[model samples]
Target: MPERTHVPVAIIGAGQAGLSVSWYLGRHGIEHLVIEAETPVHAWTDTRWDNFTLVTPNWHCRLPGYSYAGDDPDGFMKRDEVVEWLNGWLDTFNPPLRTHTRVTRLRQGADGGFELTLVSADAEQLLTADDVVIATGGYPLPVIPTFARTLDPAVRQLHSEEYKNADQLPDGAVMVVGTGQSGAQIAEDLHLAGRTVHLAMGKAPRVARFYRGRDCMTWLADMGVYDVGVQEYPGGQAAREKTNHYVTGRDGGRDIDLREFAAQGMHLYGLLEDGRDSRLQFAPTLRESLDSADATYNSICADIDRHIEREGIEAPPATRYEPVWEPDDEPTALDLAAAGVTSIVWAIGYRPDYRWIEASVFDGGGRPMQTRGVTALPGLAFIGLPWMYTWGSGRFHGIDRDAAHIAASIIDRVARGSAGSVVTDGATLATTP
Candidate 1:
């Protein structure tokens, strides 16, 4: 084992959240060390699909005092542009990060602090810090259920995380499971590549790719739909929660409706029961729900536009994309035998995996039990979590605002002599973008 080192703050993950914490710490003259499993923005540089682009607009990619500098404000940022921005930000902040170092274990430490076991490319070491920030974000590992393992030996399976582009797929028809952002994007790419595509639909909400004249996200943020911090006021909490409470959002978050896919011969099916003779079926209400979500989203965006104009903020001109439409019923079980989709892409969202933190820090769902990133354990803190503060709190475009709040809390703890302060109790899972 390598010799241990100490720091005031220890941050895990080198993505946007971790970098934001380092940036804030530097501003406050705090000493910290960041340990990253890979280089900064490795998710974008290495794992992302070749055609992947950010759903978020460029203007919102600002973190705390830093902004993604460029000329196109309304355009969606491509993966390469994001990498460039992250690298430039790294040069400016210079966070003390040890690349290729992975956190193997974390547990309660002596004197009310955290003990971290880490393995680098060359050696292993144990270190302790007064505070720890898990910025690993939500996409730590790709999730595939045991049921997926039951596929025929001839069938293929792959997680969306491992998917880079349609060209990377094996020859044959492709089936995309899960209807979330990744699944939707991948399905589109495969379909565009002239591959037969099948989409497996479940209870997942279908969203639109863009709503009205602007991205659905911008409208949501402007509506304060994600601002759980203001929930202390009357009706405020409900309003924020209502905006993004369901997997399906109003305007389906601007997703290309699956209904449209069906019209184009992209079979979208569902399996109600896994039985020996059970066959795939189509469900029409599901298609209606997907379309309805978009209609609701458009209304919400319009309402938000009115509010923005009323508040005197220069609301950006709404940019709209014509969504593909399909006047058809929902489906169950893909006709892969007929459609020839050789592969299925599951675009479901990610779930946080805290298996490494053997400590009793997470809940039944695997999320840390904290009130705005402050854990029950003394001298231990968490930052860069989804809904850790507000709706936009976890996103790179607006994550810094939330990090600043967490940093303030940390600073207050240090000034108060970390031990005396009472850790906040209660659920603090705010809605994040």
Candidate 2:
């Protein structure tokens, strides 16, 4: 065994989440190490598409003591611009970051802390820390269905993260699975590029980009939708399971209308059910999914309408969205060769992977069972989970707040010499003053 290094705290990611935690801990003069398998902002730099942009405006890109300083606060930052913006934080505090380091195993230390087995550059190293913060974002592994292996080798397949542009695919129609943000956007990208597109739509909701003379998100922000707590949501935990509304920040911003895409010669299908070679089966859900998305869109419009009237804000006149296109036939099956779909993009989203974390703190779904980032176990916590506390918990808009609370909790534990007041269920962690 390599010599075990000891530290007061170890943050297991270097993304915005871990860096935000480091900023807060540094403020309190706490010593910690931030370890990353890649450089800081690895996901931003590596995973996203070339044209990828923040769905939220630049203003929402908030870290500790860092907010968008660019002139275009209302504009969305493109992929490279986002990378540059996030890299600015590395300069702001110059955190203690260890790149090219991967924690292969994390287990409870024999004596009152945590032990991490690391493999980096073909060398093994061991680390022990009194406290550990798992700040990796909720999505860890891109999930492609097992049936994907049954696809004919002639048909190229790529996950949404792997898709760069239409030119990267075979010179034929493209099929994009799932109607989550990525799927919708990628389908649109291919369609705009004049490539034939077959989109498998899901039940993901849609929101208008602009409403009543302002960005819908701006109104929602003012109405405190983003600040609504997990417990406060009417759907409760189910709200966290819902896919995010499909919209886009590409070329300024716009609402993704799958109906319009269908009108423009793009073949839209329902939820994919199974596959046999180049032939795939789909559920007869095209109309239902489209209606459901529009219902959610108009619902948000109605909520915003009421807010505008209640607050007497002089906003533009509002009207409900009527469906621009309707599906007359339910497309339940697709023959890839016949449809000329030479490529398929699996935009089915990702699953969380915490196998390296050897602890009892995770739920059945592998999510850390933490309340506002504090676990029931002493000296262990999680940050950057979707809806961990608020809608902004995993995004830049709220990482600072969550990190501050967790940092305060760590500080309290350090002072008291034991973890204090963390509970397994429905307990709120104290906010730092």
Badly placed stretches (over 4 Å) of model 2 are: 417-433
**Which candidate achieves the best TM-score against the true structure?**
2
Q: Where does model 1 exceed 4 Å of error?
A: 203-216, 230-255, 271-285, 288-292, 305-330, 417-433
Candidate 1, residues 1-433, lDDT tens digits: the string is 5687788888898888777877777776778888998888698878777777777667778875568678876567777778888777777767788899899998877667788999987789989888888888754667665455555545566788888887877788787766666776777778878888877655544333455456566666667665646445346433322323122221122355566666777766653233111123445445555555566545555666677677776755654324466544555444444655556565655667888886777777787777667777765667766556565656774477666656666666665754443231121112112
User: What is candidate 1's local distance difference test score?
Assistant: 0.66
Collision count for each candidate, in order: 46, 0
TM-score of each: 0.82, 0.95
Error of 2 at 323 (Å): 0.8
Point to the candidate with the largest lDDT: 2
lDDT on C-alpha atoms for all candidate structures: 0.66, 0.87
